[model samples]
Target: MTASWKNINKPSSPTTAVTAAQVANGPVIPPQQRLLTYSPDEWEGFVEEWAYYCLPAKYKYVQRFSGAGDMGIDIAGFADDKRLKGVWDNYQCKHYDHALRPGDVWVEFGKVIWYSYSGEYAAPRHYYFVAPRGAGTSLSRLLANAAKLREELIANWDKHVKDEITGTQAVPLDATLRAYVDAFDFSIFDAKTALQLVDDHRATPVHTARFGGGLPARPASEKPPQEVAATESRYVTQLLGAYGEHTGSIVTHPSALSVPKLKDHFRRQREAFYEAESLRVFARDSVPPGTFESLLDDIHGGVIDTHDANHADGYEKVCAVTKAARDMQITANALITCTNPKDRDGICHQLANEDRLRWTRS
Candidate 1:
């Protein structure tokens, strides 16, 4: 059993945009909803949803538990194909507003151990700790230490377990339990179903079941919501620029580069280009370079901005920059051997404007 002495709070779900139809129909829910409500229970649901969605198709089905009289296990079930014997697992969810202390994990671990020994269908093959909002540094460190100890025990279980009659080896919960605790998108059971489960599982507070004991104070490093939004906006702008440049260069003619041609080029090569570049840039800068052909395809295919294309002012700027750069490159190549002063002066002015705009936008 993995235990920690941390407050088990929940994450709040954000307000979702409702359509006219949904309003008339009394709120039609989408498949994957963003978590606006932050609570330990809601966070747990988010984790379960993530596991269900991101985990391989094999790990699809999941079961959750909450409420009074329930043992330490908040979720128990299997993933993978139901046809083939599924992998058994259990989950413990914690949503701490404050940083999770080392002792929180210790307590959770003990409860898991007890639940394994005494609860219904107790000892699953695998277990998990699903903290959607995130676990504190202290809790993370303690879990790491517990994992090491669990490994040692598992390696020498025969020697550790005293009773030969039971034919049972010592099983450390940490050795078997996995942690699906991180920040990302997720989708699980419906919000209403999740809320009902939480209400049903509201039982005696388990905050004091400490083994290692006491919450450790730590500085919060979580970013504010506004900062996160700003970061995302900056990232999207860069992505559009890079995408425009790559696509424009690929499609433009040396003599007559047109906007229509640039858009057409993006349509043909967006997917392959995106696939090739997505890993490198999106991972680091959150900017994805889209090809000219791809951008056009997005526009024609209605995949870019569903609203007015004018709303994507950043994309327009990037396109203008890319077109100017391509033209400048062409003119520069054309004037490489020019000896006429009048021609040279005229070409320089044109090049200067292109350079100025390119620099300004980029």
Candidate 2:
């Protein structure tokens, strides 16, 4: 039977007049501006990312609650293990088409008051209404004046908040519930601007992955310490083996590199190895997990064949494989653009450190 699926030639379609709508090119939206366009779920994800960067310093634990039954909490950062029972802060994420106003949040305030009064959780130490477009002028004014905000909440309770908190039942502002509202602290309510959220999110590791911006400037790699630390034991031993095999002598340690050329080569290799290690550290703090590992895997894949090829000695094998790695075209990994020539060579040593690559057959 003919393999029609594998046919080489296909007829091209006749061309027709195309308008701008057909091509549909629009101006690129920067990530900061793009935050306002995220879907409800995506906005919550952004809030989660922001909380990770901004809350860890002050909160012992941070948790997110979603769906219609989350009471008033969207994201909560607990100051202690007691969680809701203990001191905590609330982040009410509002993903609205326009800036949040007082009307948008009266129900939220009522829910917090009702739920906390009923002992579902203690009233949050601080309640922040985080929205992409931020709070409108009237809401900002209300937030600034705590007594007025409380008064507005009470005034709007019957119209906006009486029946809105839960799906099952309408929470009436009875005498007891009214008393709770009267005594509740309204000054805790506030808003976080989009600029503040984005600025804080910039410090997180996933920022570059979420946004297409290039990485922040890398710090200089620390020089390798004078004595070989235990972390370098495996790779350093492998290097000595390669040197011993090349010179046909028992090269026990790095200090045994008596020849000037070999000494310089060893120094450069150590420096490169340090550079690669520094790159690894930088990846841990700058990108998502496994990014540096993927770069290492790419280097290994590019140079493994050269490493297995026959050479005069182990040192020659190291040189060949490292050179291959340096010239490799690694485009897929996120860390590729952030790496240097020395990092490529150092990756080979890192692979050796893991016994993924070896300089000598033995």
Candidate 3:
């Protein structure tokens, strides 16, 4: 099951423009109600957004064509280059006010045939009709039988398809075109119900962003582990050398590690070292994973700013510097104990911002 808080912390719905009826009525309609009255163009965009996130990530190039000139396909998906040569599938979005009947599919079927016959694009691997309301029972039974769908299309051709499919020209299905249409793979065509679209949409990442569904951005309580290894040899050497300078170690050889005074200092330093190390882990974990690399890049790009008005005053440059230092210490102290990185910056800034950076000691 999805880890969404459905009741109290339910994800918010996408915002839509208020309808005129809603404005005059003094009570707003639900978003779901707004969807029922979407304009033709709006339904196209809805299907496009749905196809974009729901399609396999490898498609990478999903696009919607502008109206009228798009030769039949409304939404196109390509695996590589952004053209018909690489086009893999197409979604035809229809937002009828009622359930889809077999008669409604006539013009849609004609456009696909005429376009394919004229070599505008090859027959798509999958051709889906995505509508708000799903197929009617009559159409559903007809869709189950490919041969029956063909017969129904040919039966309704002149009345539903002929003049509507071609704007200025009358293009009747000749004997050759009729044979081609019958032989064409009807199984490739499918109807996506509104319920199906809703089901898939509810599981998408966008759904979480649209509605506060995912786990709260709270940081983990347990500190990240600090395991000192050869990778930290430079620090270990500097630390042990600094200890030797303070305590005056005379011991040489590898036995330096066993020197009593040096060992005691090292013992005391362990807690502090790991405590600082935990903060580093906390900062790294604060943002979405892998953003620390971006933070480093931003720093390399010279995006760091030091003049925090709250922390520094310009009475003297020296005074500002000392104030900043004190601010750093306070921020570091709070950051070190932060169990949740999602909490505010004194806790730890998740990302590097030009106005303010959350980390103090780093």
Candidate 4:
């Protein structure tokens, strides 16, 4: 009846694992790597969302299953509607001030083995150990050599895993259980390092929400060569509402487009709108078919890097998207309008300009 993982508040930014190059060249380090910065609960939430956003489209649902009776499973990804008792993949999120050592996780493995043996649920096709800082050197080496990992698990069973799996009863690794353990698939046990998590999350919408990786450069926007459509009235209305609230005066309609102050607001609104749209467009154009959320993620972060390392430096990444990459201009433009030229304007402005995010009419 035991469960796994802690739960915490929802996150609000991007996540990146420090690359070997970044370590040598000194790019800004992501916060999740800073010792003890994120609580276990926060890591759990991060993984929960990460799984939800990064799992393949084929996985119809990725849900949190970390509390009591979870049977040592944390995030569960389901391909069918049957939910808990169906075909699924599990992600175990672990947060440690230090990298994961072998002793820290063997018990969790034993539980998985025991639970499956007891018919609590079918063994997952994949069982990932998600650690914020990643596995320790010793563990990493062992994992790289799967045969060694298997040997080590069996070698350490009596000391690190047996008692817990047995609990109050005398359920030792009897021949039946031992055979299962001997034949158990260790390939299912994999580690998701902080860097891998960051890489995987880079394409998800909530990446920025949790890790805060800034988006690419803002793309330059010109007045689209056509007259503003009447459909754009919503943008005009919201800008006027902001102006009214900011300056304590009322100005309505595109007719006000001629007024100097309001006109500036109009231009800015249009620019922001186009930019936001461009980002969403960029997201759609980029990435694989199943990643609508990742597109949102890129737009939200105000930057999207080409998966192929087309741009290496931070400056180049932003500029390339803004000036070089075809059709990704809007992604660049919105990032500039919302996060760069000014700091801390939420997606509301981005959406308002895009016409989908409406503001108070009154």
Candidate 5:
């Protein structure tokens, strides 16, 4: 998730250009309906997003395989260090004009069983057939009843699985292979309906951009902890140095500030820093990558001149820079809408933490 919330929180469906028939009928195709028109590569890309982004916490790693000799592994999600040899799952991407049927995937079943039996890789814990049109009614029933699915596959082995496993040679179901097939678990095979895929995809950062749905609501920002966190050390030290410069003494801590007003300001600054930190975490879970960094760049560009201006003390410089940041016109970034004035202030401190901004001419 990135800092920017540009595409999120908008309408779930954007209005597309209407055709003559649609104008006359006053009907618009829904976003998911557009999947049927997608090319093979586009469909695979959608599945890839669903697998990798939507299930990050579930799978240790997700990889997409292409070209020949892949052994029917379109996408594999590893659960542990053992990778394919250990617990894993597979997502098979299929983009056809119609819904997937039993006839469409018997060979795929054979490939998985044969390859795993040959020690090429362990059989997946779960195998999902993901298609644009989803699985047909007949196939859906077979998948639901695992025994029926296995029976059909074994019965249709010669016609669909034997000659279809590879072009170079036919993989005959001999006595040993037949025994292996009988013991294999067909319960792991299933299908994800198109609607389910779309629903799950909503959790990913790319969903809004790909489907035109607005982002989910932003989570509430967390309050700062009572103790100063170690991550705040650099910026806090700089602020204390600025305060020291103003008072002509070493201001070691916030409690050391004699002026009540300065103490309040210090506390407020700490709160603002935590606010920005919360926003950074929000961006990580909600938006695309680099959103928060880009917002920082915008704030840095807006406040640099004011920071460089002459001031009687470093405190004045800090105040002026943060104020300028707050007042800065940020019409370009999508994150501007969700940001508060204090977030702009906190972002300055964040920049300082990275040595990108400074106070007291240091």
Candidate 6:
């Protein structure tokens, strides 16, 4: 049966021919061009998108708020599906480019606890600290400690001891205290699980965000001010400064052989250079008719070859293919010509292997 299936799946012959009817249907979409644009806003948008996607269809009509700054809460809304009665969840999104610190964990957890207690709706039956990136070790430890304290409080209560309430028991934290700590193996609650809880809860189709008090929507004109752009710029500058310092040290101490670090740096540089050159080639080749010729002439006449000599073998091949693609007027960076017949056959086989790729234009 497998042999028959393989025979049936054999690649078709490759021929580059376009009919007027095929052209009229539409120009082929390039893979890179077809890729969805990922803006900074969209980066955090995934938390909401995934939350909504994982949610049961009944819960789909819930109101969604992104970047909601109720202390640490990034998202707040209710899932109004009949199956999940009074189902709602608040999210504390940590868009961290770096590892989360203990302070972040304390702050967010504190917010969840605070909102649960003081907010008009009183307490959400289900609660979560939805950190998309995950929490740091220190933060995880803090959560563990909070969980331990909750356990101790419950244990003491069971034993008919004094009703001394830990800070967590005051309001919001009291309601979610049990689940947050008991649901996970605290020993293993790394940044990954901190983020995974949001999805896991959704998979079970649980709704946690419950509000008793009516909360008015802040108008678009009255939305809270965000300093994200300034913050991002500052972070970038700091990162660039750190990179410059490391690069300076590396240049001064060439004998300091950190093979892995050096290799990673070169690998990233190669990838970036390849992408930039590919984009340049793509833009040059995509110009309307006569303009491409002038662009090509300018590119060919340029001194870019001096840097090409320093490139690795794979990168050299990529450069060669890019130039060939530009000359051939191929608009895709993903399409590469194979010199060896065996390699070409392999490429065809791979392309044919996937059902989705069957209609893809090479």
lDDT of 1 at 226: 21
The runs of at least 3 residues in candidate 2 whose Cα sits more than 4 Å from the true structure, single-residue gaps closed, are 1-28
Runs in model 3 lying further than 4 Å from the true structure:
1-34, 208-223, 228-342, 345-362
Query: Which one is best on lDDT?
Result: 2
Candidate 1 vs 2: which has more lDDT: 2
Show the lowest summed lDDT stretch of 10 residues, model 5.
21-30
Candidate 3 per-residue lDDT over residues 1-362, each given as its tens digit = 66656545757774988765456555654434555788889888777767877776847688898767787889988876745755578888888888788777788888888788777777777788887777788878877888888888888888998888867787788988887887788887888886677566655545433322232243334332344455334444444444444445632222466657556544444443344344456544332344334433332233234423333221122123223333442221223234321222211112222223322221
Candidate 5: list runs displaced more than 4 Å.
1-31
Each candidate's root-mean-square deviation in Å? 21.9, 7.7, 12.2, 16.8, 9.1, 24.2
Global lDDT of each model? 0.37, 0.89, 0.58, 0.62, 0.86, 0.37
For model 6, which pairs clash?
A: 88-208, 88-209, 89-209, 116-172, 117-171, 117-172, 121-212
Worst 10 residues of 2 by lDDT: 19-28
TM match of model 2 to true structure? 0.90
Candidate 1 C-alpha error for residue 173, in Å: 15
Worst 10 residues of 4 by lDDT: 339-348
The TM-score, computed over Cα atoms with residue i paired to residue i, of candidate 3 is 0.59
lDDT of 6 by residue, 1-362 (tens): 34556557668764878765356655544322221233435434645654554554535443445543444444445655431235555554565554466534444443443444445343333444544445566555555675663454345432332122233333333446555435433332223443354434333211111111111221121211222233123322322332334445322222342556653543333333334334334333332233323433433333235223433332233334334324443222222221222222222212222221121111
> At residue 147, what lDDT does model 4 achieve?
76
Q: Give the winner by TM-score.
A: 2
lDDT of 5 at 244: 89
* Candidate 6: segments with Cα more than 4 A from true spot: 1-40, 57-62, 66-71, 81-85, 125-133, 144-146, 149-362
